[model samples]
Target: MVDIIGHLGMGLIWLAIVSWLAYDGKTALGFVALGAPFSLLPDIDLWLSKAFQTVNHHGVVHTIVFVAAASIVIGAILAKWVVPRFDGDYLVPPAGSSYVYAIGAVFVGGLSHLFADMLSAPDIAPQVEPFWPFVETKIVTVDVFYYNDPVVNWGLFLSGLALAGVIWWQADDDDSAVAA
Candidate 1:
């Protein structure tokens, strides 16, 4: 269970890389903006556990199945409502591909959170069963960093920012060259 900052940092880093590889400059930032929130989605179990006894932090909700199901619902909303509100200049998904793009963004963001927790959660939190229904056993955790390690948390955040900056800069340069 990495801190919120670490989870967000991991999301940014993972999404930035995914956006850069999968989208052009015009759409990459939008995807990042859209998906970033889902990175914290799994932690909702923290609050849900209070209302529902069955829900526990780092429990079933942390699984890939949960993420996938949530992604589908979120993706539908985005495709039907959110994406249409934005013009082509904004988060507009490619024609005929809105669901794919939206779902992928949400799924990837949740995945980033899961991966980070898997690497750090067992240090303080209960072990996460990411595979869940398919595999009841807890996945092996790396346990390299403590949950509240400021250095690790901040390092991930800063590294993510740096990577995003580099990707943006390179994209801008490429655009300039294209214009030239």
Candidate 2:
């Protein structure tokens, strides 16, 4: 699958989770809209280069370790710098905490992105272990899914766009009512 397509798959899945956290329809949908992009960001490392270099060398960005580290850094910045500057309270843990539900949310979102790419990739010169360390081994061939299946890609793409449109329409209506 193309990187964007892979992200879209993960984004839709993440939306389901975010929706569950909301109190109302609009909030639930807004959470989903906000989360879709974050869920896909771990794969931004792919834009760095084709070659892998260290622990992070194995396309470090996609690895659980790398994502966790980056998330901690990001969470810290958001909690420390951004929040205080905006007169909000520190929200995320300043120092890393044991992997909690929130951390798991991030992990699932990021790991899904990696899985999307791995399952669809033809060349795994440095093969990936979907369950690393615990598995500590690489799989030899591609999995059951095709790399760029039209049906799967279109299904996910359409779903995301449709959901986004619904969310936007609701927002626009709310805005119009407020204006009136």
**lDDT tens per residue, model 1, 1-180:** 789888888888998999888987646766777788888989999999899998878988899999999999998888778766654533445555778878888998999999999888887689888998898887466777898999989988888778767766765765688789
- The CA lDDT of each predicted structure is 0.82, 0.52
lDDT of prediction 2? 0.52
Cand. 1 TM to true fold:
0.90
* lDDT per residue as tens, model 2, 1-180: 334664675566655555455323344444454346556766565555556432332345656676677666554544444433422221222123322323444555565566665666553324445455455655633554555677766766677666656655665665578679
How many residue pairs collide in each prediction? Answer: 1, 2
Superposition TM-score, candidate 2 onto the true structure: 0.58
Among these predicted structures, which one has the highest TM-score? 1
Q: Cα RMSD (Å) per model? A: 1.9, 6.4
Query: What's the lDDT of the predicted structure labeled candidate 1?
Result: 0.82
